[model samples]
Target: MTNHSHPSTTTTHSFKDLISMRQAVQSLFLAISLFMGIMFYLFVAQLESGAMPTLERPPGVEAFLPISALISLKYFLFTGVFNTVHPSALVIFLIVCTTALVVRKGFCSWVCPIGLMSDGLAKIHSWLFKRPVHLPTWVDLPLRAIKYTIAGFFVWSVFFKMPLAAVEQFIQSPYNTFADIKMLDFFTNISTTSLCVISVLIILSIIVKNFWCRYLCPYGALLGVISFFSLGKIKRDKNNCIKCGKCETMCPGRISIMENETINSLECSACLRCVDVCPAPNAIGFSLVSGKVPMDQRKIALVIIAAFLTGITTAKATGHWQNGTRIQAYQEHVLQDRMSSQPPMKIPANTDPEKMKRMIERMRQKKN
Candidate 1:
């Protein structure tokens, strides 16, 4: 006689479990938001004041998004580091890109401040509209290309031009003075056209979930392309699926999880919404092998270990995780000395080119 076992008993996870999982991931997202805000503030402060007290980058910055890969690319091609090599930029970019490999754009969902704001806006849109809205495919696809175009422009700017004098000026400019801060006063004083573009993007993000990431964020586009080879992925066991469709609804990307069973590597963010919502016991999970590992408790420990190693290795390589406070204090002192020596100079009412040149020379001397 064959004994029949009920599936419900095998997988008894409840809504509370799903909520707990969401909270865990969302808290991580919050931490990332806080970190980005700090970075943005630093960028603004350095640019606005034209001086900054030197502060070492936090270890987490080495592997953060937009920084590492861009820096690595710059360093590799020129045999010199550019904006990509700055400690904060390098760490953030690395973390985003590497995490993308493990969890398919997890950085966007779990770390990006802009993404968090977009997510919040999406909720507001839903509440106000009282319905979920989707853009038509024709319009959506074309708009998504914008991000790629932006990425291309940035890459081209760095690689295509070899203007030695201009590059020298930029390299020696406030960028280096401020420890390679990307935010500049000019950015804060952006033209109307730029403001319009940013406004449109934010508006679009509210209208559509992940609108910027899906189509227009050059950084996300770059990372998505890199994520093609990420090891960990969301895998679905087709035989075990009961067509619940919960995963699909829960997916912020709006991917059809029920039909495909396999999450798209380029689109999935490893938010674990699908995993927690899955009713099938051990049916959906992340693994190096497709659908092979369930990411059980033991593997979760391994994942933490891997993340830690990734962080530490990155910090050590970039001089961000250095030991002792005395060295750090010295670095801070040097930065302060540099800043105090070059307070923002008011331009004199000059009537001649010679006078302007003299002023420029004085400024250059101060910078040096």
Candidate 2:
């Protein structure tokens, strides 16, 4: 005779037991923090040389819309860095559309280095305060609306049938030139106003959890919208209900996962804390409806499509795409030339404008 029994399961988990859950969330946060550090170093290296990489130029480049980068790349490519009012700046304006679409707003939780830093601050706050801070819904909800208003103003101002020539002139100006710098010496020497704005944002992050992403980040608003269509979602199994309240307590975003099987796609980070902390097995999970999403297999394809359409549309409508190609080609040529004699050429502020203009004009003429 053989005796067999199912594995005994605990009905409850202590707060200490949730260490694994915390670590899981922290792990994602740490990975992003490391990535941001590397990016900061790379950006500094590029800044010293005065050359910005394609990645560096675009803020939130990997996000679905990446309007900041798109608009900036467009401006840089079309009119050169001397123009102050280039059409490429309109890329940040696409939040209106991104928000109305898929609600993945993963930009805040997943992509933005600054956003990640803000999250790290929140973690620190939890450690120091030893309690979660809760703002009234009336206060928190309305404050959240400010980002869109800022975004709306930005869009209306940039796209209000402005003269293309005027736009090109603005982007080429010195203020716009250093706006994309890494170490931001541009603030010290050229534009204190831009520097002050950046400084204030950094300080604000220390006091408020995701203050930048939640209220100020136009990119977050955009991704928050794209998240709506994301196939992978956090779901709860209501049938296995104990109403333990652990998931609600543990959620960083303060979402009540116990009540709804489907966490609002806009807020969930896919952090899996809800899943990991659940005393009941299979109560919460990341899943595809009907079939699994091929996000991994299809990522490259999606990126290509996103890049192509965003590029072409921004180009035809705003004429920034042509400029980006020209700038990139010139950069590649410069890098190759530097490799021949010295280290990778750090672009200098004193770079030959005539040479750059000639190169860019030729590319533009050919493309036309």
**Candidate that would win on TM-score:** 1
Tell me the alpha-carbon RMSD of every candidate: 7.2, 12.0
Q: Which residue runs does candidate 2 get wrong by more than 4 Å?
A: 1-103, 156-183, 186-204, 290-368
Per-residue C-alpha lDDT of model 2 across residues 1-368, encoded as one tens digit per residue: 00011011122544444444334434554575467446744654564464655344333222322334445544555666522233333443343234224224433443345655676787776776666666689988888888767766655555564455755555555344333331333422556777788778766665656667767766555455566676556666676657798877776567777777566645665444565566765555554441243221123124323643575476457544322324444354445434564655566898898998898799879845
lDDT per prediction?
Answer: 0.58, 0.51
Give per-residue lDDT, candidate 1, residue 247.
77
lDDT for predicted candidate 1 compared with the true structure = 0.58
Model 2 error, position 121 (Å): 1.1
Clash totals for all candidate models = 18, 35
